[model samples]
Target: MNTIEHRLMELEAKVAFQDETIEILNDEIKVHQQQMAKIKRQTELLAEKLKESQSSQPMMSNMPEPPPPHY
Candidate 1:
């Protein structure tokens, strides 16, 4: 093949490889975004449960503790 034709073929190959890499990276990003969304939802649910548990519990008194025996 001629030098120009060979160079053009090489460039096309590089471009094809780059396109494949971009598609793989895009798929990975989509998976990561879905995972992040699930994690965020779980975190919010846990926070709500924590708040509910805290609210349902009784409050502590401000009274001082008595001294132990054998002072």
Candidate 2:
């Protein structure tokens, strides 16, 4: 092939390789986003449950400690 044609082919090959890599990276980003969303939702649910449990239980720090059984 002529020099110009060979250079063009080389450029095309590089572009094709870059396009494939970009596509792979984009797919991985989508998966990570989905996982992050799921984790966020789970964390929110756990926080809500913790809040509910705390609200339902009465604070009892004022209660006296019982004497040790050894005494």
Candidate 3:
């Protein structure tokens, strides 16, 4: 084949490879996005549960101090 034709073929091959790589990267990004969303939801739920648990307990500040052991 002529030099120009060979160069064109090589360029086409490189383009094809780049296209495939981009697609794979896109798919990975989508999966990561989904995972991040799930993690965020779980974190929110955990925070809510923690808040609820804290609210259910009695506050220590409200209780009066007891007499000293020396008394």
Candidate 4:
């Protein structure tokens, strides 16, 4: 092959490799995005549950202190 043709083939191969790499990276990004969304939803649910639990509990300050073991 002529020098110009050989150079063009080499550039084309490089471009193909880059395209493959970009596709792989894009797929990974999609998976990460899905996982992040799921984690965010779970965190929000947990926060809500924690809030409910805290609200249901009585304030400890209002309760009388128990007698010491000396009784």
Candidate 5:
């Protein structure tokens, strides 16, 4: 075969390897995205629970008190 034909065959092999590597990377990215979504949901739930607790509790520091004689 000519030098050009040999070079073309080598380039084709390199391209095929790169394509396979890209496919594997894409699959890993998808898995990471799923994990991130689950974490986001859990974080939102925790925030809601925190809000509920804050609202349901009384502010003991703000209670009324009797006036002092100096008042």
Candidate 6:
């Protein structure tokens, strides 16, 4: 085969390999995104539960003052 044809073939092979690598990277990115979304949802749920638990407790600072007795 001629040198030009051989070089072209090698370049084509490299391009194909690069394309496959890009596809694999894309798939990994998608998986990471899904994991991040799941973690975000779990964090939100935990925060909501924490807020509810805190709200259910009574606050001593908000209690009404007792009336003073007459002498």
Clashes of 6: 0
- After superposition, the stretches of candidate 1 with alpha carbons farther than 4 Å from their true spots are 61-71
For every model shown, the clashing-pair count is 0, 0, 0, 0, 0, 0
Span of 10 residues, lowest total lDDT, candidate 2? 56-65
Residue pairs with backbone atoms closer than 3 Å in model 5 (clashes): none
Model 3: weakest 10-residue lDDT segment is 58-67
TM-score of each: 0.81, 0.87, 0.81, 0.85, 0.78, 0.80
lDDT of 4: 0.97
Q: Write the per-residue lDDT of candidate 2 for residues 1-71, one digit (tens) a residue.
A: 69999999999999999999999999999999999999999999999999999888875666787989999
User: What digit string (tens of lDDT, one per residue) describes model 1 on residues 1-71?
Assistant: 69999999999999999999999999999999999999999999999999999788865454566778877
Residue-level lDDT for 25 in candidate 6: 100
List, residue by residue over 1-71, the lDDT tens digit for candidate 6: 69999999999999999999999999999999999999999999999999998799887579886778862
Clashing pairs in 2: none
How displaced is residue 12 in candidate 3, in Å? Answer: 0.5
Measured with C-alpha atoms, the lDDT of residue 70 in candidate 2 is: 100
Ranked candidates, highest TM-score first: 2, 4, 3, 1, 6, 5
Give me candidate 4's TM-score against the actual structure: 0.85
Cα lDDT tens digits for candidate 3, 1-71:
69999999999999999999999999999999999999999999999999998899987679898989999
Misplaced by over 4 Å in model 2 are none
Q: Per-residue error at 57 for model 2, in Å?
A: 0.9
Residues forming the 10-long window of minimal summed lDDT in candidate 4: 53-62
In angstroms, give how far residue 13 of model 1 lies from its true place.
0.4
Model 6: what TM-score? 0.80
State which candidate, 2 or 6, has the greater TM-score: 2
At residue 67, what lDDT does model 1 achieve?
A: 75
Q: Candidate 6's C-alpha lDDT? A: 0.95
